[model samples]
Each structure stands twice: as C-alpha cells, then as structure tokens.
Target: MATPTTSTGASNKLLLAIIAIFLPPLAVALKEGLTGTFWLNLVLTLIFFIPGIIHALLVVL
Candidate 1:
C-alpha cells in the first residue's frame, strides 16, 4: 500500500512564512523537495514577501 501523506496546516503556514522570511532555504526545503519546489520557492521569496512564498510552499508541501 502507498503511504499516507500528512499536512502541517495554516499554523505551519505562519511558521513557514517566518522561516522563509528569515530562514529562506530552510523553509523551502521543509515544504518542497530539492527538485522543482526549491527553485520555485526561491523565486517566489525573491519576488514577493516571505508570506507569499510561505503560503505557496505550505499549499504545495
């Protein structure tokens, strides 16, 4: 059987946003795998506030 997935939710979202703001790569690495999401998260963080990147990463993760 396939393994079930888990989510951290909005609270995690806020956490991730804070992480993304100050931690950057750590937040992205937590939410997204090293492949695609990494670059995307980096770009989003660069383009928008850490919150935006955090929101995206939270949903994607």
Candidate 2:
C-alpha cells in the first residue's frame, strides 16, 4: 500500500493567501520567494480588502 499525499500547490496557494492577508510582503516572500510579484501585489491589495487579513493571520500563525 502507498500513503496518500496532498497537493502542495493548493496548500501553498492557501498558505500564501493567508500570509498575504496579515503581512503582504512577508507572505509573498515565503510563498512566492524572489519571483513572487503577483503574490506581493495581491497581498498589498488584500490590505484594502478582507481576504488579505485572513491570509496574513493564517500565514503568520
């Protein structure tokens, strides 16, 4: 029998989303790394919206 594994892509996306909510820059850096321009921008945008806060809290905690 083989152990089942979850998809990291989905998980990472969720994690990034969470991180972006609280700390946009930090979350972007963690999720996307140096090449995560989209994530950073989204995080910044999140600052103006509710999703951003959710992302930040989830990522930080």
Candidate 3:
C-alpha cells in the first residue's frame, strides 16, 4: 500500500511531466528548484523548444 506522501509525490510527478510537455522551464523549476537544471532548461528553451521539453521530462521522470 502506498503511503499518502508517496501517492502525492507520484501525482505531483505526473503533473510536472504534463507541464514539462508545455512549459519545460517551469516544470524543471518545480521539480529541481532554482538550480543549474532550471537555468539549463531556460537556456535550452530560449535556444530551441523541443530540447527544453526533453530535458525537463528527463529531469522530472
């Protein structure tokens, strides 16, 4: 049986993954805080959108 925290975490991941498909940087920020990955995602998003989405999905999942 999954604990409440586990269930919530899973749901949060799912939501972040969905968001990653759209706003990659925001998703990365949510998952990883304002760290290097967030900045990397922002740069990737500015350079090319698809790579940012891919990176964000990788980070989230």
Candidate 4:
C-alpha cells in the first residue's frame, strides 16, 4: 500500500528528471506550473542548457 505509493512517486520523479534533461521548461511547467519559477527556468533555458537543467532538477527533485 504505502510502498506502492512511494514507488510511484519515485518513478514519477525519475520521469520528470528525464524530461528536465531534454526540456527543462516543460518539466518545470509540469511540476510548478506557469509561475515565477517556470519563467525563471524558461529564461535560464534560453540563456544556457546546463543552467536550465540544473535549475529544473533542483526544482523537480
């Protein structure tokens, strides 16, 4: 019961992390929506891929 839920949450985080690797803004948007964080991530992504990935991983995990 609780274990299943924990596994599901962990899998979801893994998926989000993968998505963040390719599309940081989309991953951030899925997790945090169109808030300041999302905008920041978008800007970071446009500025540089590495920074966006780091920010997205930090926010998602």
lDDT of each: 0.64, 0.58, 0.97, 0.97
Cα lDDT tens digits for candidate 4, 1-61: 5798899999999999999999999999999999999999999999989999999999999
Kindly report which residue pairs in candidate 4 clash with one another.
Answer: none
**CA lDDT for candidate 1:** 0.64
Total clashes, candidate 2?
A: 7
Tens-place lDDT per residue, model 3, 1-61, is: 9999999999999999999999999999998899999999999999999999999999999
> Candidate 4, after superposition: displacement of residue 61 in Å?
0.6
lDDT, candidate 1, 1-61, per-residue tens: 4333324365677787676667676677777768676776667766876555565556444
Clashes of 1: 0
Clashes of each: 0, 7, 0, 0
TM per candidate = 0.48, 0.42, 0.88, 0.93
Candidate 3: minimum summed lDDT over ten consecutive residues — where? Answer: 28-37
The Cα error of candidate 3 at residue 54, in Å, is 0.4
Q: Between candidates 1 and 4, name the one with more favorable lDDT.
A: 4
Off by over 4 Å in 4: none
In model 4, state the lDDT of residue 36: 100
